[model samples]
Target: MEHDRTRTRAWVLHPEIKSDEQRRVPEPALEEAVALAAALPDLDVVGSEVVRLQRAQAGLLFGSGKIEELGERFHENEVELVLIDGPVTPVQQRNLEKAWKVKILDRTGLILEIFSDRARTREGVLQVEMAALSYQRTRLVRAWTHLERQRGGLGFVGGPGETQIEADRRAIDEQLVRLRRQLQKVVKTRTLHRAARAKVPYPIVALVGYTNAGKSTLFNGLTGAKVMARDMLFATLDPTMRRVELPDGPEVILSDTVGFISNLPTELVAAFRATLEEVLGADLVVHLRDISHEETEAQAQDVETILTSLGVEDDRPRLEVWNKIDLLSSEDRQATLARAERDPAIFAISAVTGEGIAPLLSEIATILQGARHESTLSLTFAEGQKRAWLFRQEVVRSEEQTEDGFEITVLWTDKQAARFAAL
Candidate 1:
């Protein structure tokens, strides 16, 4: 819709197409769509519904009768925008806008809008621009369907044989090319920064989860950085990193990443990948979950699926954070804590109340410290290089001189141990 001072009244529709092989439970899905609508700055969501259908129509998506009925409702409410919480074809979008007499946005467009509003960094803005351009490029299809088609002609004949669609596509392509170049420069700068961070000995722990899953809150609690920890979806679009020295643990760089969602737009999946590169390079990944949400399990599965799609290896070190336990009932909280305690990889914590944080931090420290048990090393007197290296690394706990060598005890991280081995 129009970006102005006045709010755009919007309606949300989640189509539950029965013919589709994968179907989300409609009610929560509808709620999520409404939340997505609410995420935009100028959109005021007035009403929402879960529309059940045997199948989606190819041209208009909804049936004629249904369209007319919805049109009447829109007229009654003065709805300026209709947000369909699914993939709407360009043809269907055009036809529905004609029938409903209002602007229509599918799931992708709405997400793109929210991201556009939330992006603060220059690189983030460029990425969003590129993604929105790509989406608009695809939508160029049906808008020019009614334009005059060019027939066979020479370079100077028949008005150069160029149709409106081709011109529009060409303009969008040019815009995308320029945006890509700008984005590459920004990315290169970030790569240089990442390289500098790489030289530091601190390990990186990345926070990743579904939108509004308390990742930002946990990140703030751990690092003491005042990141935007709002309840809104896609609240944090750009990555924020901070150094944290854990209690009785090694120092680490904590990275807060943009949250994942179900059915993310493919364009964004590619465009925003650069922002998530921190996750790929992190030494420890913490998958935070809103354990209090009704559809928590489903949301966790969606996050897992996205992580796999992003090529996060199965062998990567990861921890499951069951956050927001303060929102749970006392009994459920106890049960969750008990369950988490049973699994070393799972931690139940309330980032708001700071409950269970000590244990989680201790665990992170334990993991970052590599093998907890100290290793004994036999170094001959002639092996002064290795002996001096151990002392320089400050991992030596104790040393004893024997007849021909020295016996040393050391505590070190896996990375340090590996470096020593390489030397």
Candidate 2:
């Protein structure tokens, strides 16, 4: 469907709440919020500001004076939507919308909108819809009188209790159940596909990083796949995979996954778990970092937090790819290169320029080589499926046919061995 070219005039506000302990600079946070708002199609970010607050007001979020000031600004700008850079309670959202006479979306809601717009695959679409419904369920705060009605009933066993909000919530819950069932089917298909890949015995190299961290750029550069590499945040929502050949090393499957963000909404985390399981199953994780960003360290920390939450093992093989070196000044670039040189596990490269990629690929090949092992095994004649799967994987170096079965020698990674065992 074609989107309207006339964009929605939107204003973004980053609440610099003094009591909040996050270390992100308010200016960068506001800038990120603006970028996030811009990521949505047909959104013209009219203005953005960091609203400083000594403390948050339970009902309004901001003080009366600040609210009135922002309200004036919104009116002057004719803002159609207000994007908050942090969480806004439903009460605060309702009060602010009433006060400013514009729709308000908190950080979570804005991210959900972006995900909803970007989701492509069946699983991704279903996940986004479920997450949006889950979020909308919380916002059913009698925003409309049509949603405030109570079903007629006696005041006894089945009293006049179920309000419109309750009914809506129930309906949403029902939809969620249905979506979950559909999602499970999609996940099952994905699992079968993953199993098929595992039978190929290719070491999986997963790319993970903060949004707009040049992961897709590096992925395209490395795998030569024309994935949607863009400057926008969350540009690649669906996980993409391609077989990549390493220099003088075994061929491996490289996966580009959804980007991570600081304070990613709980709804997205829960909804995208199936997508993220690819990372969990990976043989090696390549963390791509935009070293040029001022908040690079903080962003890396956020990625770490998300990975930890996803149960990525500390001992998992990982390499850090410090990307976007082209964006840095000469001196800073030299410093980054020097830092990377001192660390065997870290590589500095500009994905856009293809600088330092050859060495990175060589390093990846070396790591995969170290992880590979050769073994011999025998399968009974009854296990013809397993025998054919081995041959299809081409892992069988030599095989001898016997009356009962076939004896085979194969080369595979530990992950592959475990998967075959499970099969």
Candidate 3:
């Protein structure tokens, strides 16, 4: 991402609350938060830190002393925005902003901003706006001082539901209803398009993995398409599909989708369900992992958790792809390749270098070939295109040159036969 205008001077803080049972390691969590901040083009990350504490305060999030210390640092640096790497309540946000005199954004808020900026498709844009609206709806807590005043109800007895807050909630609900209707029309069109593709006989392979795990690189390498592949996180936000014919393998529609991260916001998880339906309907799920990262196992686990949450069955056909072997040291690279060789399901490769790709494609071909059937057909010499296509598909079992034209025995799928008949 590139930006020419002025940027927001931001600082990142990963709150390591020890009392939280599901807290991630603060060091990498902070690292990922900084990366997430960097993903947005208009945020100039000025500083970042791991703020460790025994527990979180209900109203202030951090104790007064530490808050004062952080306030002084932000003042000195002129930090315009503060991004908390964990969840922060509306009260906590209001207090922290007042104390530090800077805008406050939690992990969920930051992700929404990135998605808003990167969404390309119509459905993608609608989903991000809906997610952002949902997030803002929660943030409207006591953050709005005027909302505390009574609106139309009795002064003493009936007070809870009669406030400006209720009015704001109604507005958001109305907008959500409008967006949902528009999204329903878009989704219906997409479903029709998907149904048309279903009759084409090509399988769909979905690529899923942690953010910045080199999925787009592998996608470009396989399809020869100019997809945006960057080191930054969430570079590819919408689902990108391309037709790719593997070496001696079936032709497949490869889908590169939005990256998954640890502790994804619930709003986004629901919003992105429609975008990730490709993975649910896929014939094969290819999980790409960045093997060189120190926290590779933890990252892979996060992807698995998201997959399970999406209701992907445990027995679904899948292949674990360990990528970026070239980034590893010589000794580690050898060991990684050795492990991959032992596990037939895992492939170690560098998508950049095109190393270890042939074997992986061969495996995919082997798996898809299970549906193939053998057939004997006679083709006239005049039908040269048909003869050439059979050999190109690598489905030709045998051939004999006859006086009429040629006799060929083929092992192929129903789709292949349909294509041949059309040719």
- For candidate 3, give the lDDT of residue 6: 87
The TM-score values for the models, in the order shown, are: 0.84, 0.87, 0.83
Model 2 lDDT at residue 100:
92
- Tens digit of per-residue lDDT, candidate 2, span 1-423: 343458888999999989878735899999899989988978989899998887899999999999898899988877899999999999999999889999999999999999988888899999999999999989889765663366775675244766767678888999999999999899999877776665566788999999999988888888889998889898888889999888889899999999898988787799887667889878899999999999999999999999998999998899999999999999998999999999999999999999999999998888888676779998898998988877766467678998888889886767668879989
The positional error of residue 402 in candidate 3, measured at the CA in angstroms, is 37
Error of 2 at 178 (Å): 0.8
> Cα-based RMSD of the predictions, in order?
6.8, 4.9, 9.3
Supply candidate 1's per-residue lDDT for 146. 46
Instruction: Give the deviation of candidate 3 from the true structure as CA RMSD.
Output: 9.3
Q: Whose TM-score is greatest here?
A: 2
Q: Estimate, for each residue in 91-179, the C-alpha lDDT of model 1 and write its tens digit.
A: 99999999989999999999999999989899999989989999998898745444366544466632576776776788889898898
List the candidate numbers ranked by TM-score, top first. 2, 1, 3
How many residue pairs clash in each candidate at the backbone level? 0, 0, 0
Estimate candidate 1's RMSD in Å: 6.8
Q: The CA-based lDDT of model 1 is what? A: 0.87
